[model samples]
Target: MDNKIIAILCGLLTCFHLSTAFATENGSDSFSLGAEGIMAGALPPAGLYFLGYYQNYHANKFIDGPSQFYVDANAVVPRFVWMTNHNIANGQLGWYVAQPLVDLKVKINGLNDSNQGLGDLYLGTMLGWHHQNHNWLAALETVLGTGDYKTPSQTHLVRANIGKNYDTIRPIFAYSYLNSNGIDLSTKISYSWNSKNEATNYKSGEYFAGDYSLGYRIQPKIKVAVEGYYFKQMKDDKDNGKDIDFKGQVLAIGPAIQYANKNWSLEAKFLKETNVKNRPEGHANWLKLVWAF
Candidate 1:
């Protein structure tokens, strides 16, 4: 069984390299941030696992405004995970609070000043199952949010994930929905692999194009890591007046480094759009921090 796991990991690593080669040929510098907070757990435990994270986003185009920018600061406290001792099955229940504080210095080209506020609030939860190999895992999760934003616009989300690990290689696939007044579907796949030199101290791995990362353990008290990812936009309902649509999709990527210990941790990542679909004003970066007990 161990040998089989090792083989899978090795195959995954090779695929990672091959994917990178293909991405390079496409001339796409797409990148993604490494998984952050406790969602990036090494393995599932049998007891209650509590996790939380805070992310701040600065964007010029959250909607269809001019060069407007806003900071979205969100925190999820005590998101809980429960795993049965049997290991074949597990469940997760969690909630999060998000607030988008906006500062629109440059009014959109046409929109009025009355179309602004402190942003909306959001909350969510999930459930999952584990495979017997200790290498494969899968789950389904749902999230909903309400507040002033719920009036004209509300947030609803549902997602499914399948992930596998082989020794030092891990790959994840997820399908998600962001439904407010309009519905948005997002599909994403990512992989991570440990570097060849075990003694190098940093676990180096690369995901699609710009999604490369390096992680190092800082003794008993801390660990530091850095990573990046690419953002792409799919088709939306701009032509169909029934649904909400933005100018265009923006492609962005950035690097982030983090420090963490047993009781607490801090993370900071910067993201910028490399590709602009239709909206040029919708480009910005952000930073985030998290804590747990």
Candidate 2:
């Protein structure tokens, strides 16, 4: 009787670990949401700028599965951009690199695990154009899977890795219309292509994602807005070249406020997730700082 009890307990524990991994494998990806809001399509003048971001995310419910699974993640990312004097088609040329340090934790059925390390590296270049009241931006970004990742075969029981162990390529486009009357509209769109995880023979699907914001300047240096984002997976995941049924999607919206001066700006936002599918239902809070240096 004692032996049987122990065996059953071990099996149940294993199931819980697999379930946790399932939550991450199907739903989460390399992209970070809520990274931009107030000036989604605007780039600063030709100079070097430093941007800092902090995000806190928490989820206690899962769609299409048990609600007991919980996830909490925090990240701090610092990005540097340099816009050069050279112009491309009447647009300023710029390049940037971002590195993120992430801490992630998950709990299910009273079992919990955590991981902390660098998440990924972002390398990109962009061109920004401006008209009287309109601004446009185009960029190419790449995600390098430089974070810590472990294959199922390498882990003792569960994979609590913080990285995806795959490369991703993306193209971004943005537009902004800022009216002198204090009304502003902005949007940023991007599509990603993920490569196969050779260690596990699994490949995630392609995804389309973007951010949108509408704001009214309450004062000369203050603005308030409603901001949101949408993500849709366009293809099915695959394992060993065969398709998997899981495809995740989500939409989130929230409030944002910003204060800006000639050389620096600060922005804060909170986003609540809804209409989430094949993923964890979560909310995120973000704080950003940008300075011309």
Candidate 3:
């Protein structure tokens, strides 16, 4: 038994242990679901815009196997977008960046741990088009492993991690159809390709996630909607070249409302998860504010 081989085996076990302890079967990736609700696919006109998001996520149950754990997490993210006047493929070109500050707490097996720090950095480029009653957007986004992270030891007892400590590249497509009668249907879908974590030698599976909204305008500046998000891992996670049977999936739906004016807009939603598998069954409250400059 070589020392290097033993060390590698220990690392893989620690990786799986940490994932199960955190209660996220996919091992906590950088993409956070339920971040977009109303007007999810609509891109603003050419200008600089600022968006702020606040989310409180609470979970008391973990499905798939019997588990006694609860998680409470809060995130505050600030994003900036510059929609340039330049055109690409007959659409507007946009660039955006987001940074998140996260506070996370977990109680598993009567042991408590917490972490508060910066999460991953997200940046993307998008091309948007608006024609008559249709809106379309395509984006290439990347999540950088810029947050605080450490590999847990073989003991598997470690502090809660707020970052995935890996890079992810996602391709997103969004569409919105707003009719003359103030009815709107919008959706944004994305696929993620994850890179291996250098510290743990683990690579998370690919994921397919989407957000959808259906709304009816009650006033010129207000709308009421039902919004939701869906997530599923499309591939198996890998640890040290061995496949891990970790397939996480969830669906959440809730009511949403938004108010918009010429300069700014605010939207809020509460999503309750259902049909969860290999993940935490939880609800999230999200509030988003966007203002144009």
| Candidate 2 per-residue C-alpha lDDT over 1-293 given as tens digits, one digit per residue, 9 for 90 to 100 | 11000000000001112333232253777666667767667776777878888888888877875556787887788888888898988888988888877777777656567788877688888998878788778988888877777655433444456677888888888887887898768888889898887877777788888888898899988889998888888888787787767778889999999888777787888999999988778898988877777
Name the TM-score of candidate 3.
0.90
Structure candidate 2, residue pairs in collision:
none
TM-scores for candidates 1 onward, in order: 0.45, 0.90, 0.90
lDDT of candidate 1?
Answer: 0.29
Q: Model 2 compared with the native: what TM-score?
A: 0.90
Compared with the true structure, the alpha-carbon lDDT of candidate 2 equals: 0.72
Q: Supply candidate 3's per-residue lDDT for 279.
A: 77
lDDT of 3 at 185: 89
For model 3, the local distance difference test gives 0.72
Worst 10 residues of 3 by lDDT: 3-12
Error of 3 at 226 (Å): 0.7
- Model 1 worst lDDT run, 10 consecutive residues: 5-14
Error of 1 at 227 (Å): 2.4
